[model samples]
Target: MKAVAFVGYKKSGKTTTIEKVARILKEKGYRVVIVKSMHVDFDREGSDTWRFSRVADAVLVHAHDTDALLFRAKDINALFSMVSADIFLLEGFKSIKHVPKVICAREESEVRELNDGLGIAVSGVIASSGIREIEGLPVIDATKEPEKLAEIVEKRGFMLPNIDCGLCGFNCAEMAKLIVRGEKTIKDCVVLSSKPKVTVKIDGQVLPLKDWVQELVEKTIKGMLSAMKGYREGRRIEIIIRD
Candidate 1:
């Protein structure tokens, strides 16, 4: 699924920007999901779900049309795997590098302090102020021109597997920075987008392979598959071994 984050200072118009973007994405027939990173005190102290959390490791509150699952976990990827969508619009999560970010700011300095390399564009109140760009990042008026923002996101937004294995010299977050800066393209990622790439993961950790090694593995797999029934040329193969 495609994913992007919305970040800004308090009351920087992140909510409004996300709402507008979601509307445009929905109009274009894309299923959208919004994930917000918020403070810990979102649940009321005496609420039913909150009260249950004191005694249970996981709490599920089923209401009219919503099922809220509350649990304590440090790994976010586990939680994310449960959600499926065509487009994921995230609010907050300023530090996550797995997805491109749209910065909502009140001033230029806020953009400077908030940007880390994953930023794809600038929006929010700062966009209405006539700032066309900040540090080479385009400023988009998400409130007035959400379609343009949505278009940019559709072309550039990316979601990376959260494993930090360093096959690209730098980690995933570092590669994400290079991507937004135009130094690297999404196809450069060895696992998801690369052509004829060989990726091996042991217990969810990616193993680094040189180019020659990848070619060797790919060729060997192709040759082996050539003799199998119903095997077509250039088809991808995945082998799973469980002991």
Candidate 2:
């Protein structure tokens, strides 16, 4: 499924923009799912529903017709698996990885530095003064033409490739979801080779692994693979090292 997100600071009109976009996409006969992340407590304190969960030890539950419930143990990837939808329009997730994003820009000064690493698909500039276009990116006037914004999302959002190869570990779709949710880190994936490449950081310094360390790491990886075979066969084996 294709995915996109509408992200901005509080009170930046992101919610309104997303609702309008979703309506337009639906009119075009596309199936769309909306995912909203809120830090506020969804369940009331001391309510019957909350009491039942506490008593039953169930972390999450879906009431068939109602929405799904989740406990602290559930993460975004786990949640995505539960819902069925053709396209997911995410709101409030700004840090994960690959989902195209529409950032709400309320000031002209905010336009100078577009954090490319945020993996933004598009940016929506609110009604303001001194707006200028950045090369290779479009700055949108969100208040004037919400439907036109929807068109941009529909055009660029569907162009992404959807191979969930977990080479990115979370898979492509999950990576996009996490990016929109703003909960993903580069260190989470050991297999992503895309560039401008992500650098590994140690302490406060950026450093490359030493040659001896690299060799040791390779040996350790091979050992782990060998150990997996034993687990698959329901047997146990010990690795011994000689000096």
Candidate 3:
């Protein structure tokens, strides 16, 4: 999935800007998912949602027009696994480094915060400052021309599995920052990398492991084989992951 963030201080027009971008992307036939990060409480006592919240690890409330999933977690990768989309418009999460971000600045000082390596554009109040660029990046009008802002995201934004599987020597979040820095690629994700077939079974039941598991097993087997002084790195190997 491709992703970008709309971030700013309170009342900096993040919601409005994201809405506009969502509409524009939808018009172009791209499925979009909006994720907002906040510290507010989302539960109301004595409601059905509250009741379900007490009994399940996750609570799903489905109505005629709305569906909500409630869980005591804030992992964005987990949400990514649950939702499928072409574009993910993130609101808040100012500290996440993997995806490109458009800043919604209401003041000049807020614009300064966009210096992080992940920023691709600026919007909101700063867009009208007659400044064409900040920190060498374009200043866009997310409200007046969301398509243009969307274009910036399409060109620079990115998404990852966010599983933090640690196969590429870094978690998904860390890998994202590396990718933004030109230190990695999608193939660096062991899950997305091509490899020889290796089957694993536990107690006579075949089971599948994620990409990181493959990495761990391959390394462990390679190490063991090398200890005998006859095995080499490119030799064929097979191993099983079991409890």
Candidate 4:
């Protein structure tokens, strides 16, 4: 998966530009997911979603036509893991450093607020305002040429699960940097891989057990499973050790 952010102040056309860019990418046969951040209170005081919030952190509303999740937590990383798509377009999340961003603004001053070394391109109303580049970043007209913007994002964007689990020998942020430098591949993320991994730690050091030890552990697990009444050969099981 690949990702980029559409960032700007309130009403600066970030949402509109994201919508256009998502449409353009989808029309080109790419699956896209849009993640937006809202500052104001979005839930009503006395609504079904509000009532669900009182009892649960996440509520899935499933009706005949559509299904939506009303989630209260502000964990973008968790959300990223749940969504599967070819491209992920983020609105807001200006402070996140793991992903590149396209800054949209109505004025040059708003464009200046973007962090250094984070922006991949500029867009929205400010892109067509005679300033072709800011801080050496190229400007792409998001409203008029959304396909071009989508292409740029497709070429340059990347995604990390953002869980910081460190199973890949690097945190999500470190993996993102490595990916940009061509030193790492997305498949290196163990969390997203089809095969599961087991780690052993003893006395504050990770233990790299030998192949024979691993084989012994597997056989021992199978032996224990053979004692169970409903044991099956194809079932997968997980075991955890605290110490």
Best by lDDT: 1
Poorly placed runs, candidate 4 (over 4 Å): 44-48, 56-67, 81-84, 107-109, 167-170, 181-194, 197-220, 226-243
Q: Candidate 2, residue 67: CA error in Å? A: 6.5
Q: State the local distance difference test value for candidate 1.
A: 0.83
Q: What RMSD does each model have against the real structure?
A: 5.2, 10.6, 7.3, 6.2
lDDT of 4 by residue, 1-243 (tens): 789988888777888788888998998899899888778777777888898889896888888999888775446655675667888999998888678778888887777887445577888788777777886677888778888888889888876656576767887777776765567767776666534234454422334444466678878888998999988887776666673
Q: Rank the candidates by lDDT, best first.
A: 1, 4, 3, 2
Residue pairs whose backbone atoms clash in candidate 1:
none
Q: Give candidate 2 misplaced runs (Cα > 4 Å).
A: 55-73, 109-116, 119-136, 158-243
Q: Write the per-residue lDDT of candidate 2 for residues 1-243, one digit (tens) a residue.
A: 566767767766677777877888898888888889888877667977777777674545567687666554344544554566667888877653466777665554443333434434345545434343543345655556657777877765621323354555466657655654458643444433342222333322223444455567655755677656444433433344444
Which one wins by lDDT: 1 or 4?
A: 1
Q: In terms of TM-score, which candidate is stronger, 1 or 4?
A: 1
In model 1, the runs with Cα more than 4 Å from the true position are 42-58, 194-243
Please tell me which model should have the higher lDDT, number 1 or number 3: 1
Native-vs-model 4 lDDT?
0.76
**lDDT per residue (tens digit) for residues 1-243 in model 1:** 678899998989999999999999999999888888878786789987788899997887788988788886546555565567888888998888777899999999999998987888999988999889997899999878999999988888887766665656667888888888889876767666654477786645456667889889888988888988999976768988776
Looking at candidate 3, the ten consecutive residues that score lowest on lDDT are: 199-208
By TM-score, the best candidate is: 1
TM-score of 3: 0.72
- Candidate 2 backbone collisions, by pair: 93-180, 93-181, 95-182, 96-178, 96-179, 97-179, 101-121, 166-169
Clash count (model 3, backbone only): 0
Q: Could you tell me the TM-score of candidate 1?
A: 0.75
* Order of the predicted models by TM-score, top scorer first: 1, 3, 4, 2
